[model samples]
Target: MPRADTPGTEAAPGGRLRWWTELPLILLVYACYSAGRLLVRGDVADAVDHGLAILRVEKALHLNAEHPLNRLFTHEPWLGVPADFWYASLHYLVTPLVLVWLFRSRAVRYRAARTWLMTSTFIGLIGFTLLPTCPPRLLDAGHGFVDTMAHYSSWGWWGGEASAPRGLGGMTNQYAAMPSLHVGWALWCGVMLWRFGGTRATRVAGVLYPLVTTIVVMGTANHYFLDAVAGAAAMGAGLLLTPYVLRCARWGRTRAVARFGPAAGAFTRRLTGPGSPVAGPVTGPVAGPVAGPVVGPVVSGGCETSAGERFPRQRDERPRSGAEPDASPADTGDGAPAPAR
Candidate 1:
């Protein structure tokens, strides 16, 4: 397909199939999921201790999940309270929905896009391993943010809790919150779409998605103020790193074109060579040089006895006779005589 007026920088993307490149991406995604599960499920030792301690210290300073403002709205007897499933659903769907949309759209550069998405996701997950901060809902059971996964019934979607149930991935890392992948991925989605979104509608969609995601995590007690900030930081890191990623992509393509371009050009040139069926200056014969004239001998072939009058063709090249010219050379013209060449 032709490119849009708002072009993508994905020009000259090589002929690799989506599936082939997607292989490593799939593996990386699974690996990230595997690692995240392990981290979330296992104990975060000093990590959580420090995280909860921060929550404690923040609590002393009136910064906590159950801050007075939060307590007012989430007053006791709030239905299906902590781990608010309704809000949590938004968090889960953000990534999946955006992925599906981009895949189905008419955008160029999806392969590079998907690769970016996958790589950034794994990198965010790796951060989850290195710095495991607890969510506000989990920081000290009483005031820790709710584990919305623990809430089943009041989900906006019926099978909501079922999402996390059946141990979606074993060893769930519930407390790895220093850099929230939830926010990081959401921010990634926001940036990717914001950068690529051509239409006003698309750009707005990109901008709103992360803002909504932030609220969902906060309302569900899944992250802290700092988690969102940390996630934003992660996004900043990814953005900084993207240029290198794109540079590698560009270098790879430069090599591929150096390898393949001349071959294709040579092939095209050969197709239009001397014997080609098409007619053009380079590939076809001229009209056998421009024709000058077509004078010829009439069938009355006679030669002169004494002298034959020869015409250097007529000045206008009309045939008068093939008979020999009169030796007398006198015309019976009453008015005038035609001039001889």
Candidate 2:
């Protein structure tokens, strides 16, 4: 069934989608998530201490489920290898693909959905920076926790460190385990699919994807159960904050238009709009005039004729076919087109 836009709002015109417009922002956020360790590398001993504290709390709450799950997964190579693969792959792949799908399909809600995903990611990044905690696999070997990826290193491209690819383990921040982005992102994808998808199978897949992700992360010893809880909390924060974020953006756009008029508003929209081409000459002002008539959207109070020329609104007329369009009247008093009488 075709979905209708909500009552108070309208989908963008021409059914246009701007998947490319937000690519840079997404990449920037990911780069921050990846490199933010430099700003707040928690003390190793302190991180381990936090990990132990988490275990104690989980025990008190009777929520320390990672141990048994990790044991069950590690005992069987059949389970371990695939869980390792899921840990290594899906965290990076599924989120982006779902984002693209939403951008293409859910025109009305895409902005809110994207905002939620980005907000959650930044929240997780802040958690990693402020409260870095070690995962089960990195705990003392005397503990029963097993790093499934390390155990199955030879079977796949990952090394003995985390599931980072061989020779790149150095880049992996093993201590950034408090709020698991894997679970957070998986949950985001699952939520998007469930909310936007129509079919029962799609909804089932949405539910199963996050459920399996939670199990996989714990089974692989990549996150504590509480870490998953924190991830969900971060996602919750994101969901709560997105509407306000969008409201502020809309208010800012309205203020800009009110202050600077429609031209400023149009320029602002182009800059923020999806896949805006304002960066290049195509959307930039035409210099002086072209030898031929320009025939496109008027810019800066002037009309463009088919012959690639620009003139003020007074010259707004179609040129005769196969004829050169007239040039802007020189600013002389007599030659100017008579006032619109």
Candidate 3:
């Protein structure tokens, strides 16, 4: 048996974690993240204003990293094409690959890591809903930022509108640029690889993956510097909340089992029929020896003895004088004389 406290054996109340169960859960979270982005498409004007506001803040702080990176990628085809692919493809690919790696190799940490990623993704969605900011590429032509993904669209599956396929661009919410989950998920993947990966090469990849992802997002004009910062901060918040989320899940599971366990048992019993072991008690004499002291009358010496009499025929004292003596063993209880012993 796997010990409950063991690292890899730790699981939800339902049962040990299995890939089949975990897959649906992951897909569901992704579905929710995608659906949330589509649902919370805030006003385009407001999104543009938010985007401009972020630019102003970056200028004030002297952190205008996006401009030069965007310019470089735009002017150079080789860099721009690859960076666009990185922005469009790796955000979806690398995160899940890292998750699968953790699930297989570091089972003990997979749950918490998965929770942090999911929690952070939802937080990003909330950011999108509250402050939908336009990506730098979508800003006016005067902003000097180029949409590298659009410029290099002929080389890839994505359309000019965004990362979605040619005609499916409308299905995506392009205004959800405030907190870039692209960067956040990459950071998650990087941390997992750095912590659980035993090799030096894995550690190097861990450090570089998120760093490059941040640059790619900026170079492709998909996210601003502050957006990447917010993404990391969201991941941090998710990490802090992971324990509480797990506790609540366990609590809800316990409550559900307590509420419906007995009814479910009864339903099973009914299905199995009365003859089944779990259905009901036995009706015939039991085969084993009597369990405890018998509590009924015993027949001895032609007289009935009450309960608790261990030796029914034995007496403590002699019979009274002149009264007929107690019958001998050879004599019958009806007063007939007995034969030889």
Candidate 4:
């Protein structure tokens, strides 16, 4: 058997070490979602009205729902379904997965990244509370799209007059549909996972998730093509803002490190000066007593008697810039003083 400290096992302490690393953020995320769902909990009537307005604009011009992307959710199995299970259940898995990636990867910022993920979800939920609208399926009185969620009653959960809920236990939101948060959250999770997941399987999971979620939402009748677009907009905004947030955080960290102080400049000393760690092996301006020809003071040198006291000096015999430059040959000037030859 392999030791506990082996590579895949105990050898490394993952981000799992944090108490919230594996599960707490998930609860917090769901709590925010549940709160949004609560505020918008009511008859599906208003949602239906809002979604119809969207259809009006689409039909007003000759250029609308016939567009496959818009009708992507309007087709047979596509028109009448709900990917709510995919949307809801995925919440449990993606949270932990993000934690594992943060622990493994070096390029990521753990605390700030987590903050962004949760903040984006909260923002989406807020949109839900403020602009609740029913999806395409409930629009049977309006358009011809089907309701996949209602059709697959045995598979997942969805609500409204078209189909009843199993119980309040699984209920999330019945009318919040201006933006499809299922799509937004899925996209957010996919991005962070792809950037930070250590294993190949984990990385691939990131790519496939959003694609699958988009299809599931449309197939289930819980969203229109436009809802997915709106979800994507929210997600894109969050991701774009992440770097600026992280940059501020990193700047704060550097200031903190400065205030906390360093190791008395020992590391700094090793990185510079004549006896530096990199001084000998790598070639550079060989700092010494005498200045070399044209290139200033970069050459080999030796010891010499200066006023009877022995001291190291440059060996170049070029001129009276500092001292004798040559190492082997005895350098001297004219028969005269020759500048103390």
Candidate 5:
């Protein structure tokens, strides 16, 4: 049997989530989003007009059911308090927990999931900035959209205004409600869990989580039905755009390699150890035979019979085929043939 620590086992923490790596980036992006929303707050008059326009559209479509639903939930403290709590807490809690879970267990999926989430969130932020639609609870008193969180303030730390922390309500952008990120993020969590989860119960919870979130946001009068639809639409757009984003990133890397490959290769060669092509086999001038004439004994035979003598002897030093020994007086010095002229 394979050991638990071996590859593919749960004990092998290969792709485990690195909080130090991901947390700061996630926090930075979210902070920028929050600040950007606040910075782009539209004029109150325009925001109210936009909200009223959405209400009219919903009414025409017979989907302006938020008013009745909000009234019903707020009229009863029992239902309204829990809805308020869900609104304030789950919006911040569930999505992040799901993200952490994905990062840890489903790390291969974490990047795409995170891309869809961040993309959808930024899209929703752009909508909020360009067309700040006020929430139902923020409409004029005659609209009958009770702010359930306000009515149930005593049950939680939320102020009698929006769901911001008791004193931090001023920091929030109340008019940026057109494409509700709450619904969009909830839907992302739901879809990811449904797709990647191992159990039937998990799949069911995945579906229920988003549906319940939709209800909670609507029941609390925090978002219009149309706002929820816009949120879902934003998520769809994100899912569609993520693949192109990844492809562009890959193309960028390929271009970078094409641009810097030669220099990178030279650097790699410099780092290579000895005996590698870059570092081995020196080739240059060395001690070799001098390229000039020779001197000394001129024997009849081509063989010089002397040390350090060059081969393929001089031209006139030829040996005749049927000739007898010379016995000449010059040859008497060593009994060798006379020198060739």
Candidate 6:
């Protein structure tokens, strides 16, 4: 179990979890991800070059899965329209839904899961900033890949530029495609369901969700095979680093408390006002002191006490023979009690 001071460990008073605190943290991370995509719009020429380079490598390795899948989706409207919806909607919808489910149902595992997701998202942001590659759909027409989201724009709310709503595509960066977070987030959701979700239905959904998401990303021409591979790799790296991130957070929290706890307590007391019960010294009636030592009842031999008795049971001091034992014996044992002097 994580310490209460650790990030994501506790939010509400008395170390209880609260959705209000959690929702803001999640929203902040997502906002940063969105802002990152908008800010790190790399040069179009550079992005295109990077995308073409990936294509050549995929060709050499015989991993050109995106082309055939893109072609099939392009030709079949039935498949294409739904794939666009999955691309535009489920990527945002399902991941958060799974997160909410975990928060509500699997509270014990929620912190670690949320941390892993946030860490992976930041890692994906780094990939976008460093090596922005244009997605397959954004490639030249000669590449023979169709942007299904754009092709089926009439059937959905998304615009031709990207998955963003109509007239909002300009806000999105079409070239931040080196690591597809769509697939990465889907994989995270799948793993969470598989590991923490105890039902057979949830486990099945877990397996299919990521698999179908990978297909949808490629079939929609939004990502190459390598892009999907990189996304999974980013998640793997995030999983490996989560423990260390948590440890660092724990250490920092410990230091902060050690350094500022007293001051913080004082500040809180001031805020609560001088008459606040917690800030004021405790007061009540006082009992007069006793004159001498107060002793508890003594137990005779063979008398069984409760589990946590401090003193051992005394030995029996009965007069076994005709003579009576001394009132205050020097020793009490199985042997004869000490005789009077």
| Clash counts for the predictions, in order | 14, 13, 0, 21, 0, 0
Q: Which run of 10 residues does model 4 get worst, by summed lDDT?
A: 7-16
* Per-residue error (Å), model 2, residue 273: 18
Candidate 6 accuracy as lDDT: 0.81
Using lDDT, give the best candidate's number: 3
Local lDDT at 289 for model 5? 25
Q: In model 5, how large is the Cα lDDT of residue 61?
A: 94
Better of 3 and 6 by TM-score: 6
Task: List lDDT for all candidates, in order.
Answer: 0.56, 0.78, 0.82, 0.58, 0.78, 0.81
TM-score (all chains, Cα) for each model: 0.58, 0.72, 0.75, 0.55, 0.70, 0.76
Q: Candidate 1: lDDT of 53?
A: 70
Candidate 6 matches the true fold with a TM-score of 0.76
Candidate 2's residue-wise lDDT over 1-341, tens digit each? 45644322334322234546578878987888678854667889989999999999999999988989899888988988989999889888898888777766676777788888888888888898888898889999887898899888989999987877899878878899989888889999999889888899889989999899999999999999989989999999999998787667665654566466656544444443445332233444333212222246555566346766665666556888898966655455775665432
Local accuracy of candidate 3 as per-residue lDDT tens digits, 52-97: 9999999999998999999999999999999988888898899889
Where is the poorest 10-residue window by lDDT in model 5? 285-294
Instruction: Provide C-alpha RMSD values for all models, in order.
Output: 14.8, 12.4, 13.2, 11.8, 16.8, 10.8
Q: Model 4 over residues 227-249: C-alpha lDDT tens digits?
A: 77788887777767776765565
Top TM-score hit = 6
Model 6 C-alpha lDDT per residue in residues 211-312, reported as the tens digit of each score: 999999999999999999999999999999987776665545444554567654333423222344322432432111212232334757568878655556
| Candidate 2 deviant stretches above 4 angstroms | 1-17, 252-262, 265-341
Please report the TM-score between candidate 2 and the true structure. 0.72
lDDT of 4 at 285: 42
Of the two candidates 1 and 4, the one with more favorable lDDT, higher being better, is 4
Per-residue error (Å), model 4, residue 101: 3.7
